[model samples]
Target chain A: MNEIKIFSPATVANVSCGFDVMGFCLDSVGDEMVIRKTEKKGIHITHIEGFNLPYETDKNVSGVSALAMYNDLDLDFGFEIEIYKKIKPGSGIGSSAASAVGSVFGMNELLGRPYSKRQLTEFAIKGEALASKCEHADNLAPAMFGGFALVKSVSPLEILEIPSPKELYATIIHPQIEIKTSESRALLPKEVKLEDAITQWANFGSLIHGLHTNNYEIIGKSLKDVIVEPHRSKLIPYFDAVTKAAINAGALGSGISGSGPSIFSLSQGEETAINVKEAIEKTYSKAGIEYDMHVSKINTKGIKILN
Target chain B: MNEIKIFSPATVANVSCGFDVMGFCLDSVGDEMVIRKTEKKGIHITHIEGFNLPYETDKNVSGVSALAMYNDLDLDFGFEIEIYKKIKPGSGIGSSAASAVGSVFGMNELLGRPYSKRQLTEFAIKGEALASKCEHADNLAPAMFGGFALVKSVSPLEILEIPSPKELYATIIHPQIEIKTSESRALLPKEVKLEDAITQWANFGSLIHGLHTNNYEIIGKSLKDVIVEPHRSKLIPYFDAVTKAAINAGALGSGISGSGPSIFSLSQGEETAINVKEAIEKTYSKAGIEYDMHVSKINTKGIKILN
Candidate 1:
């Protein structure tokens, strides 16, 4: 149980209507890691890239997570870790989850891989709560296990794997704008009508059923979020145009990704994915917002050991 | 269109954690009706059995539904319906839905059955709302269409068909106690923490996935309702005993049946179903509540034509 090279995928939490409980992994959107053994008795923050991440253990999300696991497990092993942070931060794409999960995964191997992926995800949430001020594993679960994941319970941290169906493509559009979690969260209303609440639950119920049964048409109809999107879509530039454009381009459905500034459109085929990306970028261009596009398949394997 | 006969089966809404969106049919637990052509050009209801039900057009859930379709569609024929109410009222099962959907289904046949099952369920909701004051087709969806169903969105009324799933048996326990829908609904809280809300969604998501992938274990694991169960369980005399008894009797999972005075247990086989029924009855006996039991396979068909 010495040095280990592993990978943790980036996740899109809230996958349209799944807010806080549903998430899926991306093959093309994630982070990579390399872990090496040292004679020293503790973890060392070796490297970081692709984002201006801090190295001062406290400011380094990945570093702090590795430290937490080491302390919590009471292990006296030495390791140096290098992280390749490919996904951008503050883009509503679960950047913090990538770092925390990546650290836990790499370190778990250095400690004999005693914990399972589910265990690693649990341990990772402890670090995320410190960074996010609330214990949220919506992103972390998918990042650890890949595919479609659900957090059955939180206090004890129950993670359940959702069966992923084929022929699904995800198109992501990063508007190159920053929307902090705090600001994004503030836009939601505290109280909702009982009617709205029931509606949300009903739609959410169908969305889960669709994902479980691989009923794509149902999934398309169910990917609507009334609670947050109405309020938060205002924060993203050309949110409406981007959504309309994605649908026009053959997307089964489109909605704000996670907290948002980053928008995602889901389609049924590869061609639809390509069309959605093109449409999204075009919408952003029309709205005068700079954007980057990525077309990907749903990654079923979340974290993997990369030699 | 010529006169015809249509049947809508009884349904079980809220398959444990699904609440307002997930529902399924119980073939052995349902009702039946027969609609025949008449020269009278109006609506008439008769032949309700097993318990007292309203016969007046406005007061009858089923009768009102038949009238709604007759008025809305402006059909040229009259219908004489004989409802064989097999499932008892106040059983926490979709008793009222059986009537509502049953009427729509029968009338649809008389009008050449132009409306799809989804459309029929929508018409049924018009009747359900008149009785329950909420526009929910959770029960009707499963009733109109066989197997497990979800009413994804109700405005245009989107329906998603989920698998009824094998390796599962339903054991329903009727305590011979009545809990009105309005009284049962009064127990819920106005608001819940985001964390609890997330758990509800998670379990729901897992249940959907379980049904799709035919993962019974995950379905059992996901059988939880944080929002309604906590508040409603207090009304049941031996709530914990019934569930514990059922689980101890080889049941995979168990929970309250919609606005329950009745409890339902999910078991793996015939043996477990028998055991679960005994356990539920025993628990009720210990609590001094009168009861009866029905052990059944998940019914896909709604009401049927006895003739």
Candidate 2:
């Protein structure tokens, strides 16, 4: 297969109680890419569309990730990439992750699937690091492996795939505001009270159990971020109002997605997800903040091939 | 039932990574009690053997817990309890928990079990607080609910019963020394680093997932304690040596049972448990510390009835 077309998924990381270590894939929003084999010996970003992104191989996330994967392989030929970017950069819903995952996934497929999905995640995070300035697998793992992902240990690069409930869906509302990763990170305290840490871990353990058992109430109750959200939410306009509206409209829970500017809620069904979306829209409309929204099923099969 | 004879198991709390929130019941080590319905109007401690403990109802853990349960119920008749304490206090394993759980469990049986295992945990913590000086459900939950238990929250009392792998076993070594709960608690920092908290939650989530799926290797990997052990281990004699011995002998993982002095290790099967026990015995002997040790399977039934 000289040429391949694929759809790469967007992801929500730091999922409420699971800060810096957990994430889930989304189905409705993503980017499409076409990767073609070339005689040249290095990665080439031949075309880009729908987004203002650099065409240089080292500067782009997809190209960087593809290069990371390619450099390890003793291949005779190189690859040219065409990105049809749809997910916006800095949306806090893993926009860069989509592109990073897409290129590696496509290249791996073209090479007749030499590396495992987990290996692909390792490669993707190299590209993810270029954007976040930190090596984190929370977004990359979910985008590559699909469903819910738990980054057990980053040093060892262990990613545990958690099964998503069949009816689970996500509603994302990206308020068009830029919150620099460094700024959001700086707002957090260097040290947290041990009492709060215990509460956070308890909720995190319960959330994992709830996901395993398909208990919606437990999931809802456990979606609390006592550590990061309080400080970071101040950066976004009407954060609390949007979350309260989503919860009142039947979302299982709501929290600032990733580092925020975008908010996310998980609901048990598509109908409730749509309700959550409409509620967020109403709240954002009242707040007079420009926003983009999408309702998506928890994508069980992450990056998909497109003919 | 006019009179009930029961076996309430000892429990190992803070199973490595699950500090302050997780625990598992033990099979071979526990306390026995005989609870009898009496014409008396209040709790009476009639006979005591094997251990010198307070006989007054309010001062005694079992009496306190029984009273806590009794006060909630408008019982026309009071109860008498006989103590056959085998598990020693200040052993780090849940010795007081056995007594507390036994009284309430026997009373619940006599009263036709109005309270669930979860509710029993609530009553048991009332007794546990007398010893620990704080409301912690880690020990009580496992002693009441059986298997492995996750104390999701203290307020509003949520206990999530985790599945124990069939082949799992515990090896416990109790060095005859006193480490006051207050002193042990004082050893902990009021605030912990954010990076350490992330590692802790990641391990916690992985540990819960491992328990659910019966993945022993994953369970072994996830049983890491980065938060509390560093300070607390100083109080225990041969802590590092014993853990090293246990690990070298094929135990999955080891840590301080609750606070200090007593150490526990988990292994995959009976043979490994015995090996771990022998290894710990060797280490403690070399250190010349007077110690008591037991090897037992993970008790799936928390408390049991004896005719």
Candidate 3:
């Protein structure tokens, strides 16, 4: 094929108790990229839309990820990419990861699908590293592979797709504010009490068990983040109020989406998801903060080909 | 019924990466308890065998656990318990947990099974606290519930059972030595580097996923214990050599069993379990350390009723 267009879903990383190990994809919010095969031997971004992201081939996530894939394949042809970003930048909902994953995913399809999903994830991670300074696959893994993913190890690039319940829904709220990734990360303590670490891992293990077993009560109980949330929630406005309201409204679990400004919750059905969204809206309205909310089922199809 | 007899399986707590939250039960090694109904209002231990344990109701785990159950039920009739301890004390293979779990389990049956498994576990933890001076349900949960269990929260007593593969086997080598739980626990650092803690939680998450998905390779990769094993392994003789030998013998994963003088390895089949046992025997033989080895399938039945 001469050209390809792909839709890469936004991802929720950390998942509270899981910290850096767990994440899941959302169906409604994401970034779209169109890639066209070109005669030239180098990648280029021909156009950009929506969010004002860097368009430089080396600087942009899409461009860098596409370039990484091209170099890995030693391709004879290059690609011209067009970006249409729907997910907001610095929204703590994996905006950069969608761009990075969508670029390599679309490029690989146009290049005869030369790489496996895990291999493509490696390229996407290179793009993610450009934005965050440290490499992490929590967002990119779910973005490429769809559904809930566990980043078992980064050195060998081991990623496992966890089976989630069919009726699981996601409610996400993006408050009109920005939290710098580096600044949010800097708020965390360098050392953690061993007792807290045990509790965190126990919750993480329970969360995984809940996903596999489809136990909503266990999932709700396991969603607590005693380590990172207690420290980072101070930076987000109305964090406690919003979370408490969502839980009261029947959301299975609620927490900051990635860093801060955006918060999300998981529920069993669309009604509960909508209820959670209304709860979040009510909470934010009381605080007089403008927000954008989306309620959707978990995106089982991570990156999709759009003609 | 005049009395009820039960067999409570031995357990391996911590399970490498899981520390205070994870454990599994074994079929071949355990403790047997017999509980007879009595008209007295207070529980008592009438007899003991195979181990030099206290017969006083308050001091003995079996008697203490039976007492907890009686008090919880507010029952007029009491129980007279006899303990048959087959699992060696202080071998780091959850010897005390078996007794604690077996006592409550048998007492519950004699009392017409009024308590749920979780409720019974609560009584067992009371017994465990009498020995360790702290309440922990890691071993007791698995001993009472069967197979692999994760103690998500100790306060409200949340335990989740993880699915295990049908052919999973455990190879345990118990060296004839004693390591006090308090002494082993004292070796751990109160604070852990956040980086190591993250790695640990990642491994723990991966291990749970592996168990639920029946992915052996993932289990092998995630069985590493970076937190407690490093400190506790120093107390066990031939810990490193035995572990290395078991891994080399085609075992999927190997590590110290609990705060161990006993080391265990997980494998997929009988052949690998046997091979691991032979390898451990060879290692201990060279070191001239007396050891007892048991190779068996994962215990699907935690506590069994015996006529």
Q: Kindly provide the TM-score of model 3 when superposed on the true structure, using C-alpha atoms.
A: 0.98
After TM-score superposition, the amount by which residue A219's alpha carbon in candidate 3 deviates from its true location, in angstroms, is 1.0
**Residue runs of model 3 more than 4 Å from their true location after superposition:** B39-41, B74-76
lDDT of each: 0.77, 0.91, 0.88
lDDT (tens digit, per residue) of candidate 3 on B187-301: 9889998888989989998899999888899999989989889999998888899899999999999888877988889999999999999998988998877889999799977
Residue A117 accuracy (lDDT) in model 1: 84
lDDT of 2 by residue, B86-151 (tens): 999989889988988999999999988899887887887898788778888888889887899999
Supply the global lDDT for candidate 1. Answer: 0.77
lDDT of 2 by residue, A1-307 (tens): 8999999998999998899999999999999999999998889999999989999999999989999999999888999999999999999989999999999999999999999998998899889889989899898899988999999988779999898999999999999989987899889888999888888999999999999999999999999999999989999999999899999999999988888888999999999999999988988898877899999999999999999
- Displacement of residue B158 (Cα, Å) in model 2 is 0.4
Native contact fraction (fnat) of model 1: 0.55
Q: Single out the weakest 10-residue window by summed lDDT for candidate 2 chain A.
A: A282-291
Evaluated with TM-score, which candidate comes out highest? 2
Poorly placed runs, candidate 2 (over 4 Å): none
The docking category that best describes candidate 3 is high
Candidate 1 per-residue lDDT, tens place, B203-261, comes to: 77777777777777887888888777888888877888888999888887888877787
Predicted complex 2: DockQ: 0.89
lDDT score at residue B275, model 3, on the 0-100 scale: 93
After TM-score superposition, the amount by which residue B45's alpha carbon in candidate 2 deviates from its true location, in angstroms, is 0.7
